[model samples]
Target: MIEVDEVCKSFTVRRRSGRLRRSRTLVGAVDRISFTVAAGEFVGYLGPNGAGKSTTIKMLTGILTPTSGRVRVSGLDPSRQRTALARRIGVVFGQRTTLWWDLPLRDSLTLVRHLYRVERSTHQARLAELTELLELGAFLDTPVRQLSLGQRMRGDLAAALVHDPELLVLDEPTIGLDVISKATVRAFLTRLNTERGTTILLTTHDLGDVERLCRRVMVIDHGRLAYDGSLPRLRAALDADRILIVDLARAAPPIEVDGARVVRTDGPRQWLAIPPSGNAAAVVAAVAARHEVEDISLREPGIEDLITRLYGGGVPADR
Candidate 1:
């Protein structure tokens, strides 16, 4: 669905050398990086601000031409075949809106229908489906400027999908949204990917978003590809441990379990730390067979924790 090969983007900034003299320096926002996304895949692209995440997205969307390397979406060069690429891809940037501020949601979508040259009947049907799927009925007639942050985001999602684009590039799709709103967006996206097979490339500061939506993640640091693989592999690479908390029927001696070590014992409850690469379900079943289990909960390594460890002492840049 997407291919980026040794893509690099840089910028030149000028600073006053003394009082009148100026010096120009070239800063590379994205170093040589390579990755590919297969169709129907939901991949997360993560990096701190100024780590070239935006630059990469812009290059993929044809908003900016890369200084070096190649970028393709759906087999077309995004920079050279922008018009064709646009028709196959939908983009949603949470901090910015593409909808007209003064227009009602319905009006904005009407414009989109015309802009995309969608058949009236097809547009109508898709609009209705999107409206219901995104729960935008109440605000269909409400102006974009009048809707709450959450409502506006739902509208954005619907707007992106109205054309039924094969690919979606979402930048912080859940930003500023409340818990319910976030869940709504996540569930909708999950269904879209699973049922419709829309390829999604999500970039978010919220690790929770990646945790819920992405199985494969690409981590970028200092404009370099730090990691690219499944979330489980990423965690395993961090050498962290998975914790299992078990509640027993009664307080007993520290339960010695194979493949796991007791890290904490609080009354009848005990905390066991299993190797990050270990089989958690097997450990759980083994312990349960020996003790009367009242409750069990597992805490996988937190995404944010792992990411922080991955980018030690790197301050988040405001790109």
Candidate 2:
């Protein structure tokens, strides 16, 4: 449903030099980034701050034109066919609201319905469904400015989908939302993608969102494609060491455990990263034999650790 071919976006950024001096440099926000999302697939687009994730989304949504290369959504160039493309996609930017601040949520969504030129009957039906599903009835008559962050976010999501777009693009859809709100949004999106077959391209800093919603994940870093595949494959391919966390009865120098590298130490606690193929039992036995182990546990590496590895030094690129 979406395709990017060698897309690159560079901006002229000015840096302050010495007093009364300045320097202009071409900053590459996205560099030759290319990927494709299959129709009806839930995909996560992930990157740290300044990693070009937003730049790419902006281009796809026709908000920003790519400096180089091409972006196609639903086989049409987003930049050139923006108006037409608008009808095919629904976007929810967590930090921003499309609803009118001073207007009641109902009015705001009503305006969106008309803006999309939806039929009256269709609009009413969809609005009813959205209000019920998003549990917006309590605040449907409430002014958007008065709604809590979570309530506003819910309103925003409902506003985006009033027209029932075939594709949904969400950027940080759960940012600043409480646990219950996040869960509500996640559940809605899950139903949207599964039952409605709405193609989704989600960009988020929260790994929990990605882990929960996306089966296929794409990692972009330094404006380039770092990894693209199923989350499991990406985890396995990175082959990041499994960590063994041990707390000694007394504070001591980093545990001299064999077959594991001490990655971090906090007085009584030490974190040992063992190779994926390394035996956890053997490492635990070795550590217990040498020290007064008060507590020991193992934890599998998570997406955050993988992204850290990417930025620390790009993980060996795997598609």
* Leading candidate by lDDT: 2
lDDT of 2 at 65: 91
Q: Which residue segments of model 1 deviate by more than 4 Å? A: 242-299, 312-319
Candidate models: Cα lDDT each: 0.89, 0.91
Every model's TM-score: 0.82, 0.90
For candidate 1, write residues 1-319 as lDDT tens digits. Answer: 9999999999999999999999999999999988889999999999788888888999999988999999989899998999898888999999999999999999999998888888999998998888888898899999999999999999998888878999999988888999999998999999999999999999999878998899889888889888888887777677778889999999999888789999999999999999866899899999999999999999977877777778984322211
Using TM-score as the measure, the top candidate is 2
Pairs of residues clashing in candidate 2:
none
Error of 1 at 242 (Å): 4.2
Scored against the true structure, residue 24 in model 1 reaches a CA lDDT of: 99
Query: Per-residue lDDT for 33-118 in model 2, tens only?
Result: 88888889999999888899888999999988999998999988999999999988999898899899999999998899889999
Error of 1 at 250 (Å): 21
